[model samples]
Target: MKAIVLGTLMAAVAATGATFSKSAEANELALSLCTYVQGDDTMRMRKKLRDSRVRVRDIYSGIQCNGQSLLQFAMSNGSQDIGEFIVGRLSVDELKSSGDYEWAQSNGHAGSPIAAAIKERAGL
Candidate 1:
């Protein structure tokens, strides 16, 4: 019985590790999607991020926001359409909880003055 219990525990740990690994991979994919989106490579962004199986926003959390939100990342970089799309998809609280709102309000739109004004206008 003890042996069986130990084996189960070990299996559980391995499974958790595997799950985390997958999450990390998904996070990387999401960041890549953002990069493509920022570059206005919508075709690739759509192709990469369209799958519902991936939690794009959750993966986005892993991205270095540079004290700015995903919206700021998109807007300041000339990806306003994608920024709007993400805003439409994400709930207000999700935006806040993700720290994007605070970052946007504080970071000055990743150092872009125009994006900073946009952020202020949007009430971010």
Candidate 2:
């Protein structure tokens, strides 16, 4: 069996914050810009955006992990800044089909950014 992956990365996570690894393979080391969103750090997100144009739009509009889009992940996890950014970037169809916007809306999560941003746009 593979190594049990047990030790808490919590301290490191709390120190650096959200989804990271040390001494990873080259492929694994290629960081995702969505990480900043997942981290809920606008400053780091903006910094990453300025630093590289690589997967930003695709990640914002389309990328998915474990049955959820970046927007889905952001909203589910209460990352509003990132969710608002995703709201600005993604199309309605994209949100409907891929970003979990519909689920979030119907689920009545008061803190869900997808629902909140759309409602805000409509001046509700």
Candidate 3:
């Protein structure tokens, strides 16, 4: 179901030359992730979180707005459920080793999924 929806979205976007948003810069998976974050589509994101097509590793580093991560972007955009969901799914090493994660860490962002979850939970 997730794959089908993603494929359809990809095909439709490609055919229409439509972009998910101005902030996505036409990145395929980024568009999906961004939308998944903002659209409250938890079902699709659960599958895509580990999907190679979504490139979770690569997305770790993309900073659409002032170096905010997908998780950060999502929660801020009012998708707390999705943010917490993905954060709970990912491991510390996976989040840390991703090229962008360390950068975000250095920049004072929560670089670990669990940590981010904690921070959000504490209302920090």
Candidate 4:
């Protein structure tokens, strides 16, 4: 009985550790994504997402860099290439609901190239 209990506890501990590991990996990926956007390294960002087998849309809502979404971050950083790339990957519904155009307009980025891309993508 003690052995069975110990085994169950061990399994639980292992599962918890795996969960934490996955969370850490996600955080690392988010940081890398933010860095790539900030640097406007669209190629590297694409490679990283492809290699990780993750799509931008899947993780878009989950990541916040400096209190801004990836698209917003890209626009703020003047990372037009990456911004367009991100905009391209997202779905029309996602783009429309993201309100990125309004955010950009209110944030003094209305004239940015990235804002134009957002408007085009969102069909705004």
Tell me the tens digit of each residue's lDDT in model 2 across 1-124.
Answer: 1333333455555656433332242223134545666788767766666665544545454345445666667776788887787667655555555525466766566556566785564344
Q: How far off is model 3, as Cα RMSD?
A: 11.7
> Of 2 and 4, which scores higher on TM-score?
4
lDDT of each: 0.63, 0.58, 0.60, 0.93
Among these predicted structures, which one has the highest TM-score? 4
- Top-lDDT candidate index: 4
**What's the CA error at residue 123 for candidate 2, in Å?**
11
The global Cα lDDT (0 to 1) of model 2 is: 0.58
Q: Which lDDT tens digits does candidate 3 get at residues 86-112? A: 665555565554433344356455555
Count the clashes in each prediction: 0, 0, 0, 0
TM-score of each: 0.54, 0.55, 0.47, 0.95
Better of 1 and 4 by TM-score: 4
Q: What's the distance in Å from true for residue 9, model 2?
A: 42
lDDT of 4: 0.93
Model 1 alpha-carbon miss at residue 96, Å: 8.0
| Per-residue accuracy of model 1 over 1-124 as CA lDDT, tens digit each | 9999999999999999999998887677756766776785766765676664654555555555444456667756777666655665555556656655555556565554433444454567
Ranking by lDDT: 4, 1, 3, 2
